[model samples]
Target: FRQIVVEFLRPPTHSDEQIRSMKAKANFPTDIGRRLRFENAFCRAWDLNLPPQQQHDVRQHILSYMLVFTTASRMRGIHPDGAPGLFDHTYEDNQVVWKPAPEDAAGMPAQAYGMQNGSADRAMGCLLV
Candidate 1:
């Protein structure tokens, strides 16, 4: 996947026009369409007997993941998988800081999307409790 992306972003072998057309297609809301399609399919796949709070919790958890994934994926420079590191610290004076984790010592950039309110971490915590 990395190889493919690196190749795609490289020069003249792929012209400006081709790159523009590819990006134009790739920029479309395909993920939204696919997610909506799957959401409907999943809704039909199971008849949940869950209570209201349980249902709300389930939806919140799903939304939390979606929010984090979307924000992280759209972040400048870093890949989606690296977004999880953004949750590894506590808010300090309203600033997002990175606590050194062995897996990701550099941590996510403070300016990364959704770093405010610790949304991703908060959502993950809500999932556990």
Candidate 2:
């Protein structure tokens, strides 16, 4: 018999609060609600969990430091084993300064993983990005 691959997408249709209430009723309350934040695609991308006016402000404040932290970690020679890939950066542009690497130095994809049959449908939810 041949293996069958069936792909599906579950839209974020239930609010975290709703999920939490359901879980608590089932005696399986969890912290997953804290991470997922919002339930819908439009809200998630816009980070609408925050007040409308504060969303842009919050995102700008945190995003500025991401590049600086990554560049500093690289310069300090603190790379985790085979990590940060082979790319470098030039803070002048705040972008990854890509360059060619030796063939053997190229990074390889990590092991593949998938949700078990029961929850695969939910976990396979699609996102535009």
Q: Give one digit per residue, the lDDT tens place, for model 1 in 1-129.
A: 111001124323334564345434331211211123122211211111112112111010111011112122111122233333333333222122222222221232222222222332222111010
* Ten contiguous residues minimizing lDDT sum, candidate 1: 55-64
**Distance from true location, Cα of 90 in model 2, Å:** 52
Which runs of model 1 end up more than 4 angstroms from their true locations? 1-11, 28-129
User: Where is model 2 more than 4 Å wrong at Cα?
Assistant: 1-10, 28-129
- Residue 107 lDDT (model 1): 33
What CA RMSD would you report for each candidate?
16.9, 19.1
lDDT of 2 at 32: 14
Give the true-structure RMSD of model 2.
Answer: 19.1
Per-candidate Cα lDDT values, in order, are 0.22, 0.22
User: At residue 96, what lDDT does model 1 achieve?
Assistant: 22
